[model samples]
Target: MQMSWHRRMLAAATVAAALSISALWVAPAQPSARNGTYFYMVMYRGGRASGPVESEMTLTCFPEGGNHPDPGGACMALREVGGDFGRLKIAHADCTMEYSPVTIKVLGKWRDQRIKFIRIYPNRCLVAAMSDWVLNFP
Candidate 1:
């Protein structure tokens, strides 16, 4: 009877893990994901480890709107770099050499092009250093 209970628990755990993995697949399948100038961003803590999501927000450049605190500012920042995350430049002056570790996943369309980028930073400050307007939520 104990063996049966253990097996049942294992099966439940496996199913939950599978669901977590599926959400992190980084695929652009939904209609919202393919929309114009859309960006779905998620921040994760724990240094490149995909354990749990810390925060997330959606930014739409075409119309400049989402849950982002400053949609207009973020859109302007993106325009400065032509909607290229790789070209995102540092706007801040200073940051520590902390090893707290933070990971960010961004996916969606920049105008007509499909965009996908995932990066792990030494700390949250670095992420903001890359781009405060586009990366900061609060």
Candidate 2:
């Protein structure tokens, strides 16, 4: 059957609209229970003459309700990347934190270790766990 270009375009547009609406109506993926801000330190081996270098990272999380005014209430996730560490995933629940043994590839050879919501301040949070990385958003 031969459909006019206008008809085809209309069909495509309808499908697109339906997909968009479905996406809007569908609930967001349930964030891990362990969520909040966290700080992490990473150490890398240095050359014979140089000592091991240490890097600092922070992770923070926000719950469905929104940002927690207190650091203890904030939520976040963390992951590690590159080198021998591979990729590590971590999350924070309340005051405690949890980690994932599995690692994933990110960018080139650099693997990342992720840590979420370890609690830094009251209501404030840290999101990413990469050295010097800070969480500015609420």
Candidate 3:
């Protein structure tokens, strides 16, 4: 006896549905994509102890959040300067002028533009004074 055309079509549809469901279940899950700006901040010493020191983090802004511990404060600081690191101003406080030699690097994308910022500060105290606690890599 031959299988009816209607029965064959129904069987094919059922198999297709099953395959589709199984494919959904078998495929690996993925992490949600991050939108807005992404930044990498690093602070390190120079000379004999030329290695990472103090702090380091991944900072995200605009939508405002990231792997950084103080995301809210960092994001707010960035916003205050219109995302321009150079424009960040120090608060009214005294800071020592001693020389220690530390380097800071901020590499990332912001507002669809690539950012590469590197600066050498005399010490952590000077870095804190100059950066207004923005970037939060300290």
The all-Cα superposition gives candidate 1 an RMSD in Å to the true structure of: 9.5
Q: Please identify which of the two predictions, 1 or 3, would achieve the higher lDDT against the true structure.
A: 1
Tens digits of per-residue lDDT, candidate 2, 29-71, equal 4323354222333222332212443233222333223232332
Per-residue lDDT tens digits of candidate 3, residues 1-138?
999999999999999999999999998542122444778778888632347576777777766666776777777877787677888887554767678787888887766677778888777777766877764453
lDDT of 1 by residue, 82-131 (tens): 78887887876478887887888888788788888888878777887787
Best by TM-score: 1
lDDT of each: 0.80, 0.33, 0.72
- What TM-score would each prediction reach against the true structure? 0.69, 0.26, 0.63
- For candidate 1, list the clashing residue pairs, or say none: none
List pairs with backbone clashes in candidate 3. Answer: none
Give the worst 10-residue stretch by lDDT in candidate 3.
28-37
Compared with the true structure, model 3 gives a TM-score of 0.63
Using lDDT as the measure, the top candidate is 1
Report model 1's TM-score to 2 decimal places: 0.69
Deviation from native of the Cα of residue 34 in model 3, angstroms: 4.1
